[model samples]
Target: MDLKEQYEKLLRYCYMLTKDVNLAEDIVQETYLRFWQSHTYKDTNKELAYLYTIARNLCMDEFRKPKLDDIEDYCELSGESEYEPEARIDSLVIEEALEQIPKDLRELIVLRFTNEMSVTDIAKIVGISRFAVHRRLKEGLMLLRRNIGGEAND
Candidate 1:
């Protein structure tokens, strides 16, 4: 695929990480820049996936830094809207629920649903077996359903 298509995918992946469009764009640009500077990304077929791995690592690094009190201000400056009342409530509920899950399982959900990456691709990216990916996905979905106020059967 071309750079444009790869970029679109990167943008979506970054947005899933930060939930801020401008931050996502910045992360995508940084990912592309890193990819361009690296020797491993010359092949167009693997470039998209390579860029995603870079973007994901960057996001994880950012999350590791200490948070500031003005983080919300930064997010707003980046054009992220304040959540509506219901959405805010739902977000809080979800956040709380996600926190209850182990980091590994949460990462799997982020890779699978947020990025829309395939199970095989996720297995490759995460360096886990396909069976492990499937198990984590199933467990994560169950946790999400319970946390989001839905019945476990759903």
Candidate 2:
């Protein structure tokens, strides 16, 4: 797969980590820059995993800094009439539900579902075992389903 194709997925992963779109975009750009600069891309077969690892590390480093406040800016979707109503509504619901989950679970869920990454790849990116990834994915999906379902019942 083309590294460029991973841009949106990587951005989503970073956004999940930082909860800030601008910061996530910066992390994604820095990830690609560092990935190219390190030249590890030439040796590593898991390009996506490597990029994700870089972005995750950057997000961790950002968290270590003392920031005044975390501005929560969800719903970055544009209010355009071009998008289908159902799709837009579903997107918002899913985004809202995802925000309610634990950060660890949320990141795993995004990597697995949004990025369409395998359990092994996710484990490598997350530095956890495949078994742990599976367990967390199951738990996260259950929570996500409950959250989405609760919204429907409301």
Candidate 3:
């Protein structure tokens, strides 16, 4: 697949994880930059996974930083109507629900759905077994459904 074709996927992957378009764009650009800067950049087959890994690590680093309460006063992002209200609402709901999940589970859901990556590829990226990937994906989506007002299985 063309690397350019993966741009939107990468953007969505980062955005869902960060919930910030500007940060997502930066992460996508940095993902490409890091790939080019590496000495082991010859492998074409692993490029997609490598790009994801870079983006994921960048988001992780951002999450590790201590957040300031005052930062919110100046950090609101503005945008126009790019998506339909219903679609946007659904995304907003899902994102909010994702925030309630544990970080690890949220990562699994983003990688599986936003990135459209297979369990095997996710396993490789996350350094876990394929079985663990499947288990986590299932558990993560279940949590999302419940959080998003789906019929609770209780």
**Model 3 regions lying over 4 Å from their true place:** 39-45, 70-87, 150-154
Q: Rank the candidates by lDDT, best first.
A: 2, 3, 1
Deviation in Å, model 3, residue 107 alpha carbon: 1.6
TM-score of 1: 0.64
lDDT of 1 by residue, 1-154 (tens): 6677767866866665676776678888887778778645556455445667788888887778886669777666656354322347655766667757777788788778755778887887777899999998999989877776652335
Clashes of 2: 0
Candidate 2, residue 131: how far the Cα is off, in Å: 0.2
User: Which candidate number has the best lDDT?
Assistant: 2
Q: Root-mean-square deviation of each candidate, in angstroms?
A: 5.2, 4.5, 4.1
Clashes of each: 0, 0, 0
- Which of 2 and 3 is ahead in TM-score? 2
Model 3 Cα displacement at 129 (Å)? 2.0
Can you tell me which runs of candidate 2 are displaced by over 4 Å? Answer: 40-45, 69-87
- TM-scores for every candidate against the unseen true structure: 0.64, 0.83, 0.74
